[model samples]
Target: MTRVLITGATGQVGRELVEVFADLEVTALDRAHLDVTHRDDVLDVVRRLRPHVVVNAAAWTDVDGCESDPERAHRVNAESVRWLTEATREVGGHLCHISTDYVFDGTARRPYREDDATNPRSVYGRSKLAGELELDPSATLVRTSWVFGRYGSNVVGTVLRLLDAGAPLRFVDDQVGCPTEAYDLALTIRGLVDARHAGPVHVTNDEPMSWFGFVQRVAAAAGGDPEQVEPIQTADLVPPRPAPRPPYSVLDGSLLHSLDTTAPGDLDRAIERVVAAMRSTVKR
Candidate 1:
């Protein structure tokens, strides 16, 4: 059986990845079991098991928190990649790294291609881009945006919760990007691993829409009133966020097309699946 080791196994994407790779000899390590930030521990464990592939889902994903603690962000997000890459290389294993569309400044009117020049605006984005730079040339780099899933707290959940509580929802309408489902991204990662596809690949839903639009869709998907989501400019947010977001972080799946690998289907359908799953879990 193929041996696969998943770091951050309890994360949004990691949880789904663990389920999808059930047929494989997979070692799923949550942060409590394996701290990727600890270089010696990572090397020790990776050298011992020497799995055929290392899927790194570990990251410091709190954008605003990263702004307040850039050093911690570097340690968790960027330095971990370096350690994992070194260890994976020692074992002659393939490394599949997760990245974000935040690497770009989001100033462009057109979608960002795989090879596009990156200009990250926030500390979180800069740190993630640093991790991208640390990857082995042959390693797979998957960049996605606006990810939501059942395993973690995400925008979808926040929207649903706020709506359920009758709280006024104000979302930025200026920033636009793809709302990628974690389950779909995990499936794409599995396919890429099987094919041994290397280099950076942009994976996201086909459509690009505003954050306001996304919340509206989430409201609709969860049987809430979409009109309750008030569309506002980024500047209008009270007690403004610490980290700056890109106005346009839409990723182009042209590489997927060029490689003949179809990106996941529409965002609406993905939202429906996620909402349904969330409801099912709640009912149980």
Candidate 2:
């Protein structure tokens, strides 16, 4: 049996990875059980398990919050990655690290390639980029965007909650990127691990669309009124957020194209499944 260790096992992507990797010998550790910042704990765990692969799904994702405390953000997002990478290397296991589209500044009109020059705008992006930089050349890096799914708070879940409360929604129309489902991302990571693919790969549901369009799809999936969701410019946010978002975050599908890996299904279809799963739990 293949032994796979998953860090950040309580996170949205991590949770899905745990479920999907049930057939494998999986040892999942949430923040409580395995804090990545502590090098001793991380090294000890990896040395003990000696897993074939280590999937790092943990990250400090609070964009605006990262600005408030850059130190903490770096510690959680970047510094901890250093220790994790070292630990993974010590165990002679391949590391699969999760990254974000934020590694790029939103200036590019075309989709960003893996080799593209990185210039992150916010502290969160810089920290994540630092994590990417710390990875061993042999480690696999998966950069994803606009993730939503069953285990944690995400754009889809937020829209559903607001719709349930009958709260008016106004999403930014200027910002656009791929909307990825956590389950799909987890499956893709599994394939990459099995193949031991190295270097950065972009994984997201196909097509590029704004958050407004995404919310509309979510509303429709949840059997709510899509037209009720309003569109607004990023500047029009009532209370401005602290971190700046990339206006165009579409990552180039070049790597996925070269590998001939099938892209995840349409964003709307994934949204429907996520909504359905959420609804099932509400009734029980």
Stretches off by above 4 angstroms in model 1 are none
Model 1 lDDT tens row, 183-272: 989988998888888999999986899999999999998988888889999999889999999999999988886775546887888999
Model 1 Cα displacement at 106 (Å)? 0.8
Candidate 2 per-residue lDDT over residues 62-81, each given as its tens digit: 99999999999999999988
All candidates: CA RMSD in angstroms? 1.1, 1.1
Error of 1 at 158 (Å): 0.9
The residue pairs that clash in candidate 2, if any, are none
Using alpha carbons, what is the TM-score of model 2? 0.97
Which candidate has the highest lDDT of all? 1
